[model samples]
Target: MKEDMYSIKMRAVRKEKHISGAERIISEKEIEVLVQQLTARALGHSKGKPDFINITIQNIGNQAIEYIAPLNIATITVDDYFKGRECAIKALQKSGLSCKTSQAILNMLKTCNTMRGAILLDIHSLERLEPDENRGVRVTNIDWSFKIKEDLEKALEKKGLNNNHVKEAVALASKVSNAPGIVAELCWSDDPDYTAGYVASKDVGYMRITKLKPLGDSTGGRVFCFDSSKTSIEECIEYLQKKVTLIHKIPMIKD
Candidate 1:
């Protein structure tokens, strides 16, 4: 229904689900394959390994890191700490992430016109003084920020769709009966600070998306995260079908 949710530049990052029986501790010569998140089938991330496998980490503290990879952390010895940081940096550069600042990323948005995906500035990214510290901003990435608080407001003013459009979408999501807490956003993708995700199950046993963002082809956004599982599969499918149909029909002001 609704053409199987029209593809957008945002594709949800999917993780099948994985729980380490024990913390994966690292040794001198060995390193851990750090992902945005680990799933039962963490290999799913292999598709975009360059981006997700952040800095090829090490479990310095013998604890499981989830969702977001720790870019830098402090240790007992300054020498050891700085060495680890240096290693991660070298690996980051080697991994092919060249756009090292929000400004560079902004330039990508302004010049490219056709974006693979957008990057949002995170705290880790904000530490850079001018260029060097400004890493982590990358294209073709579903920025976990999904930050559109201001952009969405402007769009609403621009008649991207009236208040009724968002109200209707939120209403539809909430009325699902099976899950009343369901929330929805009228996501706009073209903005550099934007990202949107798909509906997927979390390891917490709830069918909710966590640290997942999807990227696709359209600057125009779409209704992501359908097929709820808190209810019966048949009902979930039908609900998604109906939700997509209604939202797709809603008019979006084309830029």
Candidate 2:
């Protein structure tokens, strides 16, 4: 018998704030098990118990399948999830960014008190790449079925690392960094439970920053720093807006 595929998206909320989220594509037969697993994982998050859990299961065509209830569940601690603020500053300095640029990036992060898409910033000027009154660049409707994702997964697997979030972030960062004039990328999740974020560049691959935000804080976003001298703003923004971006391979940084 042929099997049907489904998309499962889960979000955990506490006091009306988004605390955590997980997404997966699986066969119909595996839906129940996957949902149960994600639900348990969200409840056990170290950020604290969620007041509500929202889950939506859908088919490949975007048709909804089911919506789950507001269930609360347990917590797990991440290794080095809270490396003092100084560590982040030092990490940016070591990445070859100027103190001014580093401080600007931190300031941008502070403004991400709510969920907004990734923001593109000019490294030299410290201005938003595409200015807007309320929102940043929205990275949506990505074609995740691309071969690049599979290749990255295999490469990451070879390294004995299999975190889906890391794989996705690396894939996106690699694409952004490879664009002409683009210098580096920094990202942390808005999900309060997930404290780890990364800084990536073409010269040095993905460097995981153990703690970019405090636990229970949902403010987080991505910043792609670019040099205006190398690439036109229009050109750089066009490249980032493309849905199918391909990179040969990501060079992973080691301790």
Candidate 3:
């Protein structure tokens, strides 16, 4: 009876089903193209040939070498045993190449296990380093790290808020059985550490949100709850469709 209810439900269901995949291996020709592009960018030259290609590369063992042509040096080496996609990216960046170029080069390097003369390249790009008059290549990148734990907590709290909102929307939709409407955040609490999902109302109590998954073993979704037990799904849905109002729609974080 509710217009667009099925569509919204389907979309919500779809977002719950997703997964990460393994990285793809690189190819030699693609590597050559990347090298050519990087060389042109770095040295301002166009030296790509039918038979061979030349570009500067840093080996995992920390050796910097130049391959004349036809060489297929892998992006990873014995020194860096774990050949992940991220590692390939680092290797490319260290060689003063852009992410796209690095990816292309990494694909080529995937062919060879180790090659002689290629040096250990630091992951920092030349452009990312600080300026130095004496240095031929200026170091520009600064090493900085964030408190991942704190960030993670904040993220989790936000997720909670989102989950709460999702539950609220669903409950409202179900209770009122009204035309499909969006349940959106109106506001959040004062605490910086709090998330949008955990906030409670004096009347509603703690809202619960149950994240749904697809048919298979896909990831994402969690169960959440609101305080009010009397609040039926249809009621919540009807309320959202007509009134669509709430206090502290966003989550709050306490210091």
Candidate 4:
């Protein structure tokens, strides 16, 4: 393979509505750095392939740069990562991240990243986690709410859903108080005279929506929810065990 500096900038998009929250808010600049670093790792320049990392941010969407090594590159334990993930999720929840986002990020850290996957394999000696009837929510499969709009647009093209129907479906999906089944909708905005697109329930680690009408009212807003009272902690744990599959040897210690 050719070794050269290459940069790929992907527009930040939510794959689904989130409710739990993120361990860390990824700024655009930080994402750029992540892309660069991951690309470099892909070229075999770093300790390993791209894994989620932490960096101090100076700004959000505008001018921003990482102030420290990515969290994954730092000297820390997997237990620390799990704890940090929980912390981040809490922060995100406070900031209004939907539950799905939390699940997606955690999943990315545990199994999707190349290095994490290797470690997980060593620890678990398994390739994937099996989801049971009671455990329907799999972290690995949970859709990132932001990415949902783009994916839904594509899914629509393939006859998966239409605009109004999607809007309606997303509306209903968002209201689901339980595990918050995925929200997929087409929405419009009243501000700025012209704005419309698809938005899913927020999945920061909790779902925030409980009905479909709100989805139709906003162009871009919270798209998911998780009613703790309805969704029992025991069920969540069982779901986590069954749905949250690791790569193999990566050890996850809950704090």
Candidate 5:
């Protein structure tokens, strides 16, 4: 019998586009540290051969990215080490991570890093969450609006939404309205560009409440909520349930 380990390296490319109200914003590194720590716990160890991976950043392209794209995007370019049947891969799948964790990790890479930064590291690079920075948003509590819900259902009916999906979308709105990480903030800029719905934020590299205005605009009004910390399909589904347990602890956000 022989023991073997694979050492791999990956290059990640980041493209920044300074759009009207869509300029890229990176939140506190502590949030990122927390998120990465969670993901590392979920995927870093399992049953796998000694595996080493080094990830690097590349900003050779000046392409502008769509504000709403990262929310629904999930792509990963792994080296030959992850042969799909690797022990770690199987353990991750058994943990029900499948590709969801990878996607979240990749998505975090896309949003959390500096327009020009480096996250290239091996297992020693497990994510970390630092102390509080008093940067989380503060918002007032208001029940979700139903009229806006009706409007959304009618507007996207052709997309083939059913009662359940309608419930999810509407629930998503309600969750954001009450979630802890989200806040009802107004763009201080004279002519601010805001994204209407839920999308991943460069802040802490998680899907946070960026803009939240119900019954406003489908693209940029309110309605933003997602669980970017989740790594498995089950966790994604469980996010809605977790929202009910949300508690603002940053000590900065007001009630």
Candidate 6:
């Protein structure tokens, strides 16, 4: 008999305001412990305790294993990672963003002391798209149930690429870049053990940069860089908050 698989989504809310959310794919045996851990982490957030927490568990069956496989790629050198970071910084600069602003975004992700969700930044005006009372937008209840194109999957398989995390990131960045005014995206994991991050754009796809933060540094967040001239702030926030973004295709990889 095969073991069961589940997708657990937890959202922290305070006074009807979205605080933070976490999603994970786990085996049946790990469900209870994982939920407890996530719950504690959310409620114990440095920012204040949430008034309520919503946890959703979906039985995605064993087939979901392919979507949550461990990243087992070989290690990369520090030099290579720095080179990739410089290249990504240059690419963002070429996309109408100032080098200082781009580096600032990267640094923010590298040391995201405040446990918040994604931040929306205007590329031209350099203003944050935040609510009147809120500091940033929380992208919650994300749908990650889309299927990949068979040919694209085959292409990735041919390249020996089996990392689902990378695939999901690229797909999400692609969807975000398609939104009106969105120019690029910067993201890194909040997990203390994960140091890899990526800079993505509609024109350049995904560019992976390693060593975004020092090992054991638990700070991380995402920034969506956009142009205010092309879209209203309300529309931009709505697209990310309410839109059911699907991963139809994985954008090309840019080294």
Who is ahead in lDDT, 1 or 3? 1
Q: Write the per-residue lDDT of candidate 6 for residues 68-160, one digit (tens) a residue.
A: 111122222345546656766776776667899888766656656444557788776667776642356665323333344455566567655
Q: Highest TM-score: which candidate? A: 6
Q: Which ten residues in a row have the lowest lDDT in candidate 6?
A: 64-73
TM-score each candidate.
0.19, 0.62, 0.17, 0.20, 0.20, 0.64
Candidate 2 residue-wise lDDT, 56-110, digit = tens: 8876643332221110101122356445345555556676788878778877876
Model 4, range 104-168, lDDT digits (tens) per residue?
A: 43343332211111111111121222233222222221111222445545644454333432332
Q: Candidates' lDDT values, in order? A: 0.25, 0.63, 0.24, 0.28, 0.25, 0.63
The segments of candidate 4 whose C-alpha lies over 4 angstroms from its true place after superposition are 1-194, 197-220, 233-255
RMSD (CA, Å), candidate 6 to true, equals 8.0
Of the two candidates 3 and 6, the one with more favorable TM-score, higher being better, is 6
- Badly placed stretches (over 4 Å) of model 5 are 1-144, 173-255
Model 5 / residue 197 / CA error / Å:
17
The residue-by-residue lDDT of candidate 3 on 1-255, one tens digit each, is 311110011000112221111111122333455454433333321111213223333222212211111111111122222333354345334434467644543333333211111111122221211122121121111101111323433544554432323333222222222212211111111112222221112222233212111122111111112113234434433333233221112222222
Compare candidates 2 and 3 on TM-score and give the better one: 2
